[model samples]
Target: MASGSIKKEANGTWMFVVDIKDETGKRKQKRRRGFKSRKEAQAELTKLLNDVNDGTYIEPVKTTLGEYMLTWLDSKHDNMSRLTIDSYRSYIKNHVAPSIGHVALSKLSPLDIQKLVTDLRSKKDHKGRSLSASTIQRIFNIVVTSLNNAKKMQLIKENVAKLIDKPKIKKKKIEVWDVDEIRVFLDGMYDNRHYICFHLALLTGMRQGEILGLSWKNIDYEKKLIHVTQTLSHDRKEINHGAKSHAGVRSISINEKDVAELKRHAHRIEEEKEKAGEELYEDRGLVVCTNIGRPVFADTIGKMFRKYYRKFNVTPIRFHDLRHTHASLLLKQGVHPKIVSERLGHSSVTITLDTYSHLLPNMQEEAASGLGNLIFSDPQKNEL
Candidate 1:
């Protein structure tokens, strides 16, 4: 049996004190304060007693949101990528922890989360600019995920974060280079040292990490195929085995011209190795590396890319925009979306269509015109 009592407090509020026994049969008093009315306190007491009677009671603890989030992050370290984990930690330490970190995890409310989202929208980073909608949305997602986990662990009766609306994010227009622009850039950069890196990005739509992680063993010279098997981490400190997703592990076919370029690049590597000597040179069998066989940093590549595009007087776009340019060009050429999706290592064709939906209107018009020409053209007239 369970027993409890509710009474008015000296501060003109209501409090409840429940008599309960621990797992070891030791008697204890569970006290909760700050209810607005006696009825409210009574209702809470009734619920607590019912929970205990049904063996569903969870002992209350004073764990703060800050403390619990750190614990949650630590638990996820093994399952998440280092880049992802670092991003989450940055959000927690910089935005989340400083604001509502002192609040009790059990006491966190939907209103609190909503206010947090509102504040984040107005908040500025160290650069003194307002947080981007995407960034706010990410932080909101982290809070929702953390609270959901808390509910699963029985630390909270319900996930309060879910009761609130998620932050709305505005989609940014995708930037890509046109065919003429690509040709101009490539022709100018053809003799450059890092030309092959830019060439592979535009040709195969391989990610920067995938390009940097490419090994000699993954390339099939006779078949003219490149197999994506691994990626370098963003920090350039670790080589993470496997692709970003299951679909990311795929083979991309290359033309004979591409094979020739790669072979030329391989010869360049051999010349450098010979100059450095076997004792001084470290051979990790990487397709793209520094003179001493060290992995080239992603930032270094981005800087070089920016420098070349500027020197070529081409309209500026990020290195990643090169991958986008490849997909855009292929889609514009009437290649099926499924093929584009597979080549880009997207998880699904739907993602490919959604990403390039802006291009669909033109494609639709072209298809209609092509259909009309096919059905209405006179074969006899054409032969005459």
Candidate 2:
């Protein structure tokens, strides 16, 4: 039978000590202190004895939140990408570790997590601006995930992070350019060397990384399809040989005009290769590359895009906005959401719908008008 006793300490507090058998049948004393009264200590000791009898008692650990999180991150190295692991490490080292890393994992409470959220809201970056809602939410998610793992490992009785409310994230409005703006931008950038890069983004809804990672072999010229099989890391240091998600691995069909433009772009690359000579050109088979065939940095592309948009007097939009513009134009032209989702490599049509829900009202109005015309138009007019 499990047994425990409570004793009044000289410091005017109460303590409980219980003798129990561990999983290996070895006797050990579980001691807890800092109770305000003998009654309080007795109640806790009784619960401990019951837990020991039920085989639900967890051994107390002194592991701090910082230490456990570092161990957890190390465990994730083989399972996660280097970029993702780096991001998590930054959050732990820069934000989490500085704030509450010293707090013991066993003693972590919901209020502590809430305080972390509050501090993150008030914390400023190098630009003196507070952390964005999305970023704070991501950090909160990481904390919750780490605590959950601790609970699963039987290191903690509960996950305090789960008891607290998640950080609120306000969705930013999606910005896109209209068809006339697209035409104007294309007209002005036709002669630019990076024209094909932006064109593929707008035409295929391919991400900047996907476009930069594109190889000549991935394109089916006769079929007018571009297979998205790989992507470049944001820093341009690594070429990950797969899509961002399983659904991201898809084929996007291009128009005949786009195919012809791509062919012309390929011919230009061939000429550039000849001018650079065999030794000078490091042909990695990338569709878009520098004169020496090295991959262009993603940041450089963004800066160049920004410069051209300002020069052309078009409303400023980021490079990724080009993908949104592509999807928006297709949706406006009455393409099915499923088809758009497939082309954009979204995991599901629901995600596509949620992202483009703003366009639904206009689509509904058009549908209503088309329905009226179908029902009210004269038979003769229809025949003609």
> For model 1, which pairs clash?
none
Error of model 2, residue 298, in angstroms: 0.8
Q: Tens digit of lDDT per residue, candidate 1, span 153-250? A: 99988888889888888777788988888899989988876788999999999999999999999999999999999998889888888898999999
How well is each residue in 343-383 modelled by candidate 2, as lDDT tens digits?
A: 99999999999998785567878889999999999999778
Model 1 residue runs over 4 Å out of place are: 1-3, 19-28, 46-57, 368-384
Give the Cα RMSD of candidate 1: 2.6
Lowest summed lDDT across 10 adjacent residues in model 2 is found at: 357-366
What C-alpha lDDT values do all the predictions have?
A: 0.90, 0.90
Q: After superposition, how far is residue 169 of candidate 2 from its true place, in Å?
A: 1.3
lDDT of 1: 0.90
